[model samples]
Target: MNQFESLSRRAIQAPESGIVAVVNHGRLKAGLIPLWAGEGDEKTPDFIARPAAEALLAGETFYTWQRGIPELRQALADYHGRLFGRQLPLDAFCVTGSGMQAIKIAIEAVVNPGDEVIQITPAWPNFAAALGMSGGISVAAPLDYVEGSWSLDPDRLAAAITPKTRAIFFNSPSNPTGWTATPEDLTAVLELARKHGLWIIADEIYTRFFYAGGRAPSFMDIMDEDDRIIFVNTFSKNWSMTGWRVGWIVAPPSIIQVLENSVQYQTSGVPQFMQKGALAALEYGDAYLETQITKASAARDLFCDALTGTNRVVTQKPDGAFYAFFRIDGISDTKAAAIDIVDRVGVGLAPGTAFDKGGETFFRACFLRRLDHIEDAAGRLADYISSL
Candidate 1:
């Protein structure tokens, strides 16, 4: 047998990344006006990046703390407090390489090999891989689409719980589909966790990108100090610092130590310059973030308007995030559909199957580009659907 056979089974068997991999394969040659990733097409704000550049200039690139620099942790704690109206202790917060890493660290802390974890469908595909890497089996609980929106069925999710279920991963202002969990939805999930004694890993990376209202409600809003919830968030979306790789997890003090130790081996710490940049963002990046939010909201509206009368497409007005997830009524081959659109219509999007098995008939469009580009892409997408 080949020595690398196991590697092929483990890595090759992994699910394909819907949009990211497609975009990578297509590159600029695809002639697709790319909107396949979750990040905005804007660069990090000057107020956030300037300090990091200055720090680099000062030659302060050495390692700091394993968990995080105290200043950055404190800033994150303060930001959490401001958003949720409660004081989150610095000791309960641990920083990681990115929001993605935060999820992996949290999963590693709680899940053992063969433990079952439930993930909501139409989720960020990376979540599943993170759980798999930790030797946990992923159980998908799909959301139902109703009246141009997506929602979770609490009873179905509750029923999926088993004694071996260790955790459930949830994303709000969710990636691919801009589905923001409502207050009731969060409460119900938390209640299930309480009943089953399971962990709730909430990814709130896109929390600040809400478009329907000023702010998206968080699980933290309703959670108490005693709740078994680990809230993951990052400065990536709001501060336009996707490349900075600064994110944090808020858990009870019990799991914080596990996360701290896990990250110590995985990555010593987030870079000092990046930590300083994150602190500056928390302190002074609000105005710039607000401006970007306005632009994102406008782009979302433009896309929605463009798809209004398209026959084969059905999309809900997203409440948060920059994505517009829609069903291609008769298209079953989302991967081929995505590739076809890129080659023929010059618009790039993610196939729904990347998010979950139930996503085969769906497609996701990112609206985080310039308004004109968004309008143009939407028109191109409409034309493609019409041709189909």
Candidate 2:
């Protein structure tokens, strides 16, 4: 028997991230146009970047507040007010290392061993793995993509709730499937949460990419300040600061307090200089986002147009977020298709199985590329489908 066999069973059993699975399958080759992971190609704007350099030069390297610098938290509070007209109190925020870390923090704060958390799928793979680390179950309630676009069926989600269900987490303008849950849909889920006394975790990393309502209507929009809901947001998506690794959670004071303590174990504080740049992101990143939205909308159109040349797949234009999730005929195993595309077309895409079994015949492509590149990738994908 292996010496490491005594390690935590859940840790060993948990799957590696699907994004990594694509990479492991062969993505390191030269000249492969990569669109597998969910991030934009844009650089962090100079307005945000310069300040972090300035802060670093100004010797702001030391640790700061455990929750986050007051300036950054308040900046986020103001930003939320500008979007939702709900001026969140400063007490409701906790700036974690990244949106992923914020997810980890929320999973830690709310889930108990052997408890269940219902996730709206297809979800980011890390969500399930994180829950497993805490010995919590990640039960998926898949989205209904019936009319070519993605939507949450409130009744389906409500039915997924069990006596052991402790929480529900959703991402809208979701990754992999650019579905933005409507305000009515959110309210119904919130009602379910209230009925079951379940925590609500909202991952709003892509809220800015939403096609309507300025920003996607959020959990905070319909929630009472004291409700058991936490919002996971990031500078990564909207501000283009993925590598900078900064994100925050919006929750009740009790949850924030718990996070502040738990963070001391995971990461005591986000870098002080990085928080300064985050301050700049909130102050000045709006214009960059507007420009990006315009470009992203065009990119989305170009991607859909190119995909139209292929008769094998069906997808509506994504209403929000940056991905195009579509199903293909004749491909019962999407991972094999993903591998074939990578080998033949020199384009890397994620198999649907990475997201959930419900997505097995589907594949996800990030359109966060130059419109020309997106078109080229789509053409290649179309050729592959035609060959099949």
Candidate 3:
């Protein structure tokens, strides 16, 4: 067999990230207002970065606790208490390298080879990609998209479960769609998991980015103590620490050790200095987070209005999250359209083809940026759509 064919089937069959492909094409272009990635255009605030740099310089660079440092975990507990109004035990938190790692760990913990995980779509592509790498299958339960709004249908989700299904990977205030689940939606999905004896991997990293006054509704608001839910979150969004690669998991205490063991085997643990920074973020970054939310709220309005003004884009201001996912009236092949838009307009956008099913005809633009930049990108994109 050839060298490529000799690799494991899982490794050989893994799909390239469609988002990254477009990014690679446009990354070098001058004056590109890139909005393809799911991050804000801010650096880690001094309050958070200074401590980590000090810690690293002061020799805090050793291997650390597999779960996390006690202070950081406790801080996570406190943060949850404030955000979710429920005080969770420190044992429930397991630190991972990033939110992506947390999802992989969750998949490894609950899914065996050939097991299926039902994910809501059009969803972030990473969960399915990670599941496939772990030898599990990803089954899609696409959301209901009507007009410019997206929502869940309980019966549709319940229909996706099968005898081999082991878990449900749910991302609210979703990456591309910006579809925030309502309390009623959360309750129905929780009830469905209760009936099916399936685990839930909740990705609520965008909860704080909600534009509707307060944070988005979460599974924590309604789950019982014994419910099988695992929360995967990151410091990337709220604190502008995407490059830090620090995230944490909140699972039942009984499974924290199991998840930590997975950590033990993969990456050992997040770097100690980084954990110190994360602690600072949980401790002193609330106001900074609020500022990011405010920026996102305004950008959401401005960008959505600009797109809708073109009358060739189908979108509304998303209920939450920092992205505006819309379909241009004449663009059918989004992957090619993304490349053309970036080349012609100098505005980088993620093609809906990167997102899973039900998203193939759309484009996603991250709007968490300076107002002027958003205005510029929006104006350029509006002109592009007008020309179309």
Candidate 4:
């Protein structure tokens, strides 16, 4: 058999790439103003890069600890403590190649073959793929859109759990939707997990970018030390460190060991210089991130205003994060609509169907571009919708 066909069936049947793949294929014309990706169009702050460069100059290129550099882990622990107002030890955290890898390792550590995993829908599309790759079945619990806001139906979510259900994957300051779960919602989900003895894998990558009150409720606030909760976050979004590939996992000591062993087997360790860069980011990159958040918030406002009163287009002003998820009237094929937007309007966006089955009419526009780019893209989108 050919190598392609000889691969595992599960690997072969994985879902196709959605919006990112479209952008990669040059669907959007060059210089047309693109904002489809989740990251901002900003470089890493000098405070972060200088230290990493220094480390490299000092010949800190070799692999260090399998878990991560001690100083970086300690910085993460301190940062977590400051954010949550609780002391989290350095031993409770493990560094991975990226936030994506952190999620993969967490799932691998907790899920066995055929175990059922519940995921909050309108989620990051890759979450389902990660679970499936770990041999887990994904059960999507979709959020209800009301008054331009997305909310989880706790009862529906609980009902979806079966004895085979081993975990629930949650993302907040969610992708595509830009909805931040309230404390009450988190508490309700935690209660359900506690009752069912299910694990919780909370993806908080966008936690630091919250536009509302500068903070969003987290599973860490409600979870007990012994609860089966794994918190995964990265320096990617907040610090403009997407290319740095430094993310972390916070879990119980047992799971930490599992992740350590997995890191050793899967990729050995994140680069030592990158770990140092992350440490510098955590210590001195706050002001730079704050400026980016302010710009994103302005872009969010401008884009939402531009799209308002357009026929058959409905959007919610995001409480946190920088995405504007909107539904197009009478448009059922989100993938086609997204491609059309790029091809005709020169504005790239992620298709709703990429996030979930229920998102067929929805599409996500990232607001992390420059203010001028946002204005230009908004004009193109307005013109396109008007013509339609």
Candidate 5:
């Protein structure tokens, strides 16, 4: 006789976020070094914030088009063109509240009830959640964690496709895993998507965090205007604007229309001032982004070397992103291990199971904090592993 009993079965069956569960368990404890989310400790730069403030001062805070203000959309198109060296047009770009919303909107627009989406794992849980919230099924095709790094097997992914599969979900410089898909991998996947007549939902949110270069190889670099690709990115990583909640998507004109309609029902558009801030980021964020990428590259080496000192834990320096995804020998219950480490060592990390299948015995720790904090967390984690 509970009032909440009227909720639908999907609502009842949806599991809690394992990352949030661990964070909640550790929140009350004092002196905990948290590295549970895909975020850094840096503040948003003055140049980006000033524009939004100036817009407010100039009294431009009314509602705009749900699709986004035309200037921001055009700015994003031009920025991507400059970044990727491809001529992206304004018709292909749409703005949303966040990258998560972009993924959700793209999923809902492309899929119907009972449709299956082929996703590469160990994926961010939201990828599967987006599919589920749209009444679609997710088929996980895991990447091979070979010799210390994660690699994609395109044939394995192609094999996962079935008559019910409507799309393929791809994340490069993947969250938690930090695997950047090769250009060859992209070509292979594109061929499969074409063969199966499937859509491609690409999460390139970590594009600016590449370790070796200005940006990671992207599907956008090679995608044609008519290709079945929906690319999603946010201002969070490059501009450190996670709290701003501004993300953009690139899709075909037909789906762009759907995204416009979806944006109306989603959040009725992001704030006009916030869109101004995003435009500023597109204009002036390059130098700051390069600095952050250099910092992350250094931190990756420091953290990975710390874990490599002991043979008990297996780890690889990530090619991109700010995560150290590693495995502990003989431990199958990663969630339990992660919670125990939090309780004992005063360090926090996300368990492998929280991501998707093939994550057992693995965990993800972000290294985007201050160097001292990263060193302290690294020492604590290494000490815990050595003691085990």
Candidate 6:
């Protein structure tokens, strides 16, 4: 057999990222207002970056605790206390290389080969892809899409759980769709998990980006001490530290060591200097994060309004995250349209095909950018939609 055919089926079957394909096509294009990626246009603030630089320069690069440094874990606890109004033990926190890694470790800790994970669709494709790589099947429990709003249906979610299902992967304030779960929704899902004795892998990375007065409703707001829930969060969105690759998990104290063991095998813990910076973000970056939320809120309104004004796009200002996921009136092939939008209008958008099922005809734009850029990109997109 050929070398390509000799590789494992799982490795060979992994799909190419549809978003990255569009990005690769237009990355070097001139004057492109790129919003295809799930990150803001801002750099990591000096307050957060400086500490890491200083720590690196001071030779803090040694291999450290797999469960994260004690100070950083304590800071994570304090940060959670401030946000969730709960005091969790330090053992409940295990730092991973990224939010993506946290999800993988959570999957590994619970799922065995041939098991299933029921995920809400249209999801950030990485979770399903990562789950597949770990020999887990991802069954879709698609959200109901009506009048440009996305919402969960608890009965549908429960129906997706089969005997082979080990967990439900939930991402609220979702990446591509900005579908934030309500308090009632949280309670419903939690009850289902309780009934099914299934684990809940909570991806609440965008909780702070909620535009509804305070943070988005979280599982922490409702879960009991012994609930079968694991929260995976990242420092990327809050502090514009996308490049830092730092994320943490909050699981039952019973599973912290097990998750840390996965960390030991995968990355052997995050860099010590980077943990120092993450510690700084947790301890001193609240004001900075608030400013970012404010900026995203403004950009969301401007961008969504502009697209809506076209009268040819179906979208609403998303309730939480920084994305504006919309469908153009005449565009059924979002992948082709994404390329055309990038090549013709110099605006980068992620096609919905990247976001898995139930998102095939939509497009996702990251609106956490400068107001002027948002305005410019919105105008260009509106014009393109009008032409379509």
Candidate 1 residue runs with Cα over 4 Å from true position: 6-12
- lDDT score of residue 79 within candidate 3: 97
Clashing residue pairs, backbone N/CA/C < 3 A, model 3: none
The per-prediction CA RMSD against the true structure, in angstroms, equals 1.6, 1.4, 0.7, 1.4, 1.3, 0.8
Off by over 4 Å in 6: none
- Model 2 lDDT tens row, 89-140: 8988999999989999999889999999998888778888889988999899
**Local lDDT at 217 for model 2:** 76
Compose the digit string of candidate 1's lDDT tens values, residues 247-334.
8888997778878888889898888888888889999987888888898899888898788668666677798988888877678888
Q: Candidate 3: which stretches are off by over 4 Å?
A: none
Error of 5 at 125 (Å): 0.3
Q: Model 6 RMSD to the real structure?
A: 0.8
Per-structure clash totals for the candidates: 0, 0, 0, 0, 0, 0
For all candidates in order, the CA lDDT equals 0.83, 0.85, 0.94, 0.85, 0.87, 0.93
Candidate 6, residues 112-212: lDDT per residue as tens digits? 99999999999899999999999999999999999899999999998888999999999999988999999999999999999989999999999998998
Checking candidate 1 for backbone clashes, the offending pairs are none
Order of candidate numbers by lDDT, starting with the best: 3, 6, 5, 4, 2, 1
TM-score of each: 0.96, 0.96, 0.99, 0.97, 0.97, 0.99
Cα lDDT tens digits, model 4, 66-108, are 9998899899888888788879888899999999899889889
Worst 10 residues of 2 by lDDT: 18-27
